[model samples]
Target: MTLRLGYGTNGLTDLRLDDALGLLADLGYDGVGLTLDHMHLDPLAPDLGARTRQVARRLAGLGLGVTVETGARYVLDPRRKHGPSLLDPDPDGRAARTALLVRAVEVAADLGAHAVHCFSGITPPDTAPDTAWQRLTGALAPVLEAADRAGVPLAVEPEPGHLLSALADFHHLRTLLGDPEPLGLTLDIGHCQCLEPASPADCVKEAGPWLRHVQIEDMRRGVHEHLPFGDGEIDFPPVLEALASTGYDGLTVVELPRHSHAGPELARTSLDFLRRAAATTNGAAPC
Candidate 1:
């Protein structure tokens, strides 16, 4: 299977969706990790069917595949950054979060996207650990059900400072959910490096069976900054080799929102880097 290369719209947050697609196409990406938000195609907006069709047609024109991501800050709470989480104190607030994710799943179904990238929000500051997990799983059940009905996979991403912070945490989450088919992992390589002692390559191998989506970015050993290619401590060659060995036929999204101003340049550089890395691993000449 070919490795699918894509970029996150988080990096192109300033550009219109059409322009972002055109720029990504021109830069030679095969897919996009479209982060659903207000400025871009707001998945919560009215006339979602028409909007989905429009986006699908545009992506088709560009020959781009998509994976929907739901990490938009403040989408649920205007006054808080990632507030009203799935584990919120208020039951109504948690339901609101679930409804938002259900909406995202419907949008993903409409676009024929491969999967939806989701995350467990930060635990409320004062809640007990057991209570937090209970609330989180309880909040996630409805979204998982909706995704099952829509025939879409939900990839739960482990973030640096969130409720689910590592592969081990993800394993715990999977066990808590009691069903692996509807819930899978979105392995963000940078986060793994920051939070775990294992190398990114080793993490990929360890999490091989559970990985449904992947994100790549450079980061230092103990920090979570999403750096551009070659700017951090990650050894891309071995990481690519590990992915190749797994025969993972999924999107490897380049997520560097900080470099959004250099979107075109970053996209070109990242794609070229991946091509060369893959070619070297396969004993083929780089383009």
Candidate 2:
């Protein structure tokens, strides 16, 4: 079993999109988590279809795979980070977020990405839990249908402090959607360590069947910060072993959206750390 490594473009916000992809390729990353934002690929850019095709060509030339990420911080609302999400109170807001996700699925299809990563944003304090759940499911119906037709999986991530904040929440969502074939889980290792009752490794085992995408980073228990490999309390070797045991063929992507200042160097170090962890835990190196 081989576990490919990738890095998120959100961590390379300082670099131009082309430069970031080139840097990741040069650093031996197997894939990239392409987050659509105004500064990056800009999902709303004019002639986006042609641009997506061009990006596909670039990735093909570099021998790198991709997973379309829709968690761009300010893409939806410049005034607020990750605003107007699936759980938004207003119908129009929910529709806008859904529209963006649909576009992301289309881009993922064009790029041949294994999945499209997204999350239900924070629920308003005044909104009832049941109402928020209903909003999320209703918004996702069209997005899931789009993904199904495009032959791409919609990997919904469990975000801390969001409407869906844990593996159980994701399961609940899947259940509500009648377990749509195109719906899958974007299992973030850091999130598991921080918010889950189980260890990151255990969470991987639990999420194995529906895990279509993964985000990896070092994180402390109860904290939502994304840290470098050695800075956090997570024991990565065991986690790597668990993922390997699951026969997961997708990329374990490093996602440090806040560390773009040192993206090139950080990307190199992150890959080395993952390789060493895999070697130590599994007795063989990860490819």
lDDT of each: 0.86, 0.92
TM-score (C-alpha) between model 1 and the true structure: 0.96
Clashing pairs in 1: none
lDDT by residue (1-287, candidate 1, tens digit) is 46788999989887899999999888888899999888788877887789889999999999998999988876777898777788899999998888888999999998988899988888888999899899989989989998899999999999988888899899998888896588988999998778887999899988888787899988888888999888888877777778767767778899997888888788888888878877766522232
TM accuracy, model 2: 0.98
Mark the 10 consecutive residues where model 2 has the least summed lDDT. Answer: 278-287
Q: Which stretches of candidate 2 lie over 4 Å from their true place?
A: none
| Model 1 RMSD in angstroms | 1.7
The TM-scores, one per candidate, come to: 0.96, 0.98
